[model samples]
Target: MSGQIKYQWRITKYNPDYRDENGYYTLKEEWTCPSEIGKIIDGKEFTLEEYLDIEAKYIDTLIAFIIESGLNTLRILQLSEQKISTEDRSSVLYETEFDELILEEDKIVTLNDIVIISKMILRNFVHCQLYLKDRFFAHFGWDYYMYIGSSEKSLSAITIATERGLFVEEIDSSPYYFLEEDTTRLVQWSKKENELGMNEGDEELLEFPLEELRLIFNLSSQHPVVGNIKIKIEYKDFFQRYLNHKMDFDKYEYFFWGGY
Candidate 1:
């Protein structure tokens, strides 16, 4: 009998200090697609439209699962923030114990539940994003950590991996900036090439909205073996069209990839 195939959409969070002898750490929450569905084509390049077709077909289902199962935990955090804001207006000192707050059936929630939900949302988002954008994936033992805080408060939230860290970065900016570097570079290059006749420094790189960044991060982190993947497309007409129409094609040709 043949072994059953398995596929997974996975995203991971790593302990910053969890390094091996070579300075590589284990990535937590690695998701994979079910083997039955098979892997994406290894080296083929798809047009932006072609990739979006795949995402439109499959991403919603995955996103629905994550939103339904994982969003509640995040909601709990939102609720906490709301409560804090309300208390600030009344000048009430916040005194609830962390354990006690979490235990209250109506107020407190489990970190375990939040972690599970976060992982689910992240995996689904990654799968969907990869399907829509061209991307290059690479892997090494190194990871990045970021601390997110509101300018109004001393408290901060930290994200320990590239995907989550980038998501946090995009919370205040646009998502388009987070697309595959090739797309961004191409867009910038195209812009520069067109503005060559203008005074130096007259052109700026195109900017994307914050939501797009969140979407991209959510989508890129879904795979376990990302290093072998990349989406490279030839933009034969991009330069000519940019000059002729003064329109940007960079927004359309996004790509991404990942690895263990």
Candidate 2:
């Protein structure tokens, strides 16, 4: 019978080491360690059979966990053969530690569970300011108003939408969709000439506050709606429309930037 094979799985910490004169690590501002260079924070050897089982089940979920946990990268190695691999080692192997994947009660949570947890948190609680880039079109002489809700207000709106079996995209094309920093968003739009069919007297415009439009997306984590929320303005006094809708000024405020 052949000897048992094993594998070493490690997570590299992104600690930049930029030394000055004597090879001592310098200020954090100066450090820009290469992606390949990092100290292994946690790891252990697993039998080949054990590793195979993990690869079959937790590999993808574990990778998602690593990214969500703010880890730099994962490294996997064949201990028996002394082979090293990084990045997309699918042709060779893949990575994330089993230890770090565990949740309370030793319950292992999938990427979806993590997303639900985040939405639940934002739904019940809130932070002061959530800065977001506004991307929409407005015509001159048209009135506009924003639904400047707190993160909590956004969550409540999202929860209502979710219960109605609706995704934010179905509710509004450019609804308040907040994406993670690393996530890339590709948006495309097509317009037919005269589709708007604007009449001469249609100069006045009013933007309704669909509180249900705030849906956060993190496709990386497998959560379409992760829960962060934004909106627009024409005249300053028009903000009273939002307050008239029962929005609490003490907890939220209307804010925006840029003009066309």
Candidate 3:
């Protein structure tokens, strides 16, 4: 019962799929917890609770160490790669929590409201992607690339390659984007197509205007630029007697007033 506390640590190599001669691998270190007084320090003597606690603490410590080490590591890597932005390799760890204040069931629908909600959702998705990139790619030897969007069925999504991963940005849509005449029509058409067992034979048959809102981020970019690069409008919206569609055709009307 009076044995002195001892600690053991070992560092091992980490190999990822997308490894290159110049690419770096992680150095994983295993740290065993202090052994109990009377218990043998073998695998059988480790209790679940004690093991879990030690594992959790050890992982937390590892994350912190990785973050600190990554700062210098990333700098050197960037320098070697001829990249200037140090923030590009910053840790992407992010926390997502529901905001009660932004959860109102009813609010006056406006173009601004739609834009705000869309931006918030996009920002959250970007943050999460960045965090993952830091954890998996930056921390390990792999490269992480992502493009997040609202729907895959969207006509605008046609240009995206299927191999690339897609993530749906979630946000409260009812308050901002009202279920107006056009939306109702689209839903009805969609239901009709579903009931008839009609395959999406032609792009013109779909009612939802096929318009898609998208955001793409390139983690490998030296500047790490995130922007609304492309907008594709598939269908025309009829307000009163006037028809509005085609991003370039109705630039003033939609760009200035319509919520994107």
Q: Against the true structure, whose TM-score is highest?
A: 1
Model 1, 1-260: lDDT tens per residue? 01111111122233445657773555443213222122343344324344333323233332332233223222221111213344333322122332223321112223444333222222221111111111111111112121221212111222222323212222331221122333322222223355443322212224434244334333222222122111234432433333323433352322232211
Local distance difference test, candidate 1: 0.26
Error at 104, model 2, angstroms: 22
What's model 2's lDDT at 182? 26
Q: Give all candidate RMSDs, comma-separated.
A: 21.4, 22.6, 21.7
- Positional deviation of 202 in candidate 3, in angstroms? 16
Q: Report the poorest 10 consecutive residues by lDDT, candidate 3.
A: 1-10
| TM-score, model 1 to reference | 0.19
Query: Taking the tens digit of each residue's C-alpha lDDT, what string does model 3 give over 169-244?
Result: 2222312122123321211111222555332221112332222211111123221222112212332333212323
Candidate 3 residue pairs that clash: 92-131
Candidate 3: regions farther than 4 A off: 1-55, 70-260
For residue 198, give model 1's deviation from the true position in Å: 28
lDDT of 1 at 223: 22
Better of 1 and 3 by lDDT: 1
Off by over 4 Å in 2: 1-12, 19-90, 94-187, 190-210, 214-260
- Candidate 3, residue 126: Cα displacement in angstroms equals 13
Model 3 residue 38 CA deviation (Å) reads: 27
The better candidate by lDDT, 1 or 2, is 1
